[model samples]
Target: MSEIISLAAANQHLQYIDPGTGNSSGISEMLAPSACLNAAEKKLAFLYLDNSVSSIAAFWNFFNSNHACALLSSSMKQEFKDSLETLYQPHFIYDIKRESVDGYTMEKINSSLEIFISRISSGYSVHDELKILLSTSGTTGSPKFVKLSEKNLVSNTKSILEYLPVQSSDVTPLNLPIHYSYGLSVFITNSVKGGKIICTTKDILQREFWSDFEKYQCTSLAGVPYVYETLFRTGFTKKKFISLKYMTQAGGKLNEKLVDVFSQFAEDHNVRFFIMYGQTEATARMSFLAPEYLQQKKMSIGKAIAGGRFEVDPVLHELLYFGENVFGGYAESWKDLNSYRQELPLHTGDMATVDAAGFYFITGRIKRIVKLFGNRINLDEIEKVLNEQFHDSSFICTGLEDQVLLVGVKNFQDDEKIISHFLHSKFSIHPSVIRIKQVEHIPLTDNQKVNYTKFMEQHGD
Candidate 1:
């Protein structure tokens, strides 16, 4: 067996605090190398790692023991789990439900554990031929398993740390899942640096969330666009986060209004709001909008990180990323990493343009652009325009056979007034406007992406 180090040894003097409660778990005595070795002897592979920082640290220690490790999000649906079973055929499964660890069925538990232990003892390297499968968010189609190496995870984490700069004194309140590349990166980077990680199961947008932040004295927070949207709705004023030194937003584009609100909030609170851009393919972060230039280049995704470069292909209007942190390739069957150069200088599939200041701003997905009246119109650009005009309204623009349809889900006190305003707005290209009931909840994929395919299937072609 490979030499294993305990989390206590690695994170000496660090205390693991649960933000929801006042309880604290000290690492100096809790995590022992003997416990890790015992767990390893039991053959724990394919553990469903939870979203907490402590669980992530435990998993990392296991991985360091040279066991084949595959991370799965606790939030994955039954269908995704079923698909993963068919592909990887994991020997053991770890379920991270809420803030605790749960075991699997007896038959599954025994057989998988034996198989994983036997294989590891026979000199098989989990980081070598053994697979570490990651599922894509399934925004466009069925989620596929992307195979990665131990080097990929370690290298990517190192690369991100090089640019972001986390110190041991920092405490990151993780709001994202550990199964997710974004969430996983947060856990790994912080733990490796001996930083304090406070685990919380409470929703970050709730009124009680601020109290938890105050209780824990959280210095950093990371979230997706939806999380920030909830904060905006729940009256997230600048005064609440006096202890927060830095914040990050990712998973999707931050609407211009939210960007302005967050920027102003950061200015008042003396906190840095980093607007980052990334996908599952790149293991999480690929680019980050600099906090210093948040006001000057509000919508920009900023530049690439240390080991990555972002370029705009003018001919195709596709943003491409080239970096060592990029995945080897996607796997359809979770058998092995596919040998393909197709993703090199990885085509991000999003349309964007770089300004003279070198800030990159995404316009829309290439597939989302509509050819209207012989002119190309980006749906995202139109949505941005309409959203700015009507703050309380939600809209989606889709292209039909020859005409464009704009569906507005509005919360306007006077719907007619807002519709009339859009009818005369210069941004509107004389397209059809269809007003519908305000959407209480936007359908999202397991990865929190807008489920457009489901939307079209439910609504219309």
Candidate 2:
């Protein structure tokens, strides 16, 4: 006999508490039934899931019920919004405010519950051909919608959970935005294991993060490389995160020196620092470097997850993934799912190599490498070398036709000193340093990826 799975059975404690205000709501309370009404209802669901686990639960619940929903980030721009409205023609918009939601304008639809009940009573399967639409990082081109299905999510979540074990007692701080893949996985994984998820809408880079950690006794914290850089700059001492058990870094490769510093800091405070790797195309995580092997394999993205296997091409050196969790091919439009194929393994555009011990270390993106003077130069390598020289500063290395441009965001005097130090350092090749305008901050994508394409477009020749 087939097993029956209900939301209450799956998640025993279905109440998701907002850490910011201590407001608690049942899983059903946060959801609007009317949001899932048919095409003729003229009603749409606009979900703003910021620091609220209920928002995530509601989204999944509605999505699994065959309702159409759009993921909106707190930092979405007007251009992106205009494009989405024109394309989806969504009636309702889930406005996620970076700040407080006080005085925000949204239509108060009253028949949401009635619409939801009517749909559920009709015996509709929410998971049937579900569509999850997301915008790309807009690094290479305009951000486009990535449509995924219920199978895609369930497969990815199951595979990831097999690798990273999350117990029921584990409390994960919902730090990253749910609109992004990384943040969404945190919710999916934790919810599957019946663990407690603490919701905090405030940016973890801000001052309010430490207090929330203390209040919630959060066990795990996950972020991108830049987030860790911010914590280091904000003078976040080791004593501040006494309750933290494990911290994972992903979204982008972190500096090796910064990794060493974080490993030490976590050691002092009795926490495990995990170096993880993933992209939206493969769900959130593909592999994670264990805390114990971090020192020896400091730069490795570790081995593949339990059910997944990774191989590097002998000729091209590109990393390839083979697993069920791999997404069902890309879709240009929502109706194109019929033409999507599940054949062939996923080819990640990253160049990587496996060590003698079987640990996979990503060298860099295949396109990010520059051929200057007949010698191939990896921008990531130059960035790593520069990071080793300057501990606290942020640097982005981009390739020009004949030279590699190193952009440093630091104090004027310190920038010069760091540049001088890098020039003297022994790398296989040395590029000319062009000191551009010193800025207070580096621009990052919605997923916390360094906006390299944007940087080149705005600053490069």
Q: Highest TM-score, which number?
A: 2
- In Å, residue 393's CA in model 1 sits off its true spot by 32
Clashing pairs in 1: 47-94, 48-94, 91-112
List the global CA lDDT of all models. 0.61, 0.61
Worst 10 residues of 1 by lDDT: 108-117
| Model 2 worst lDDT window (10 residues) | 114-123
Off by over 4 Å in 1: 1-14, 20-44, 96-132, 138-143, 206-208, 337-343, 367-461
Model 2 residue runs over 4 Å out of place are 1-9, 28-49, 96-130, 138-141, 331-339, 367-461
* Model 1: per-residue Cα lDDT over 110-184, one tens digit each: 211211222223222233433245555421113355565555566667776776757777777767766667777
lDDT of 1 at 459: 59
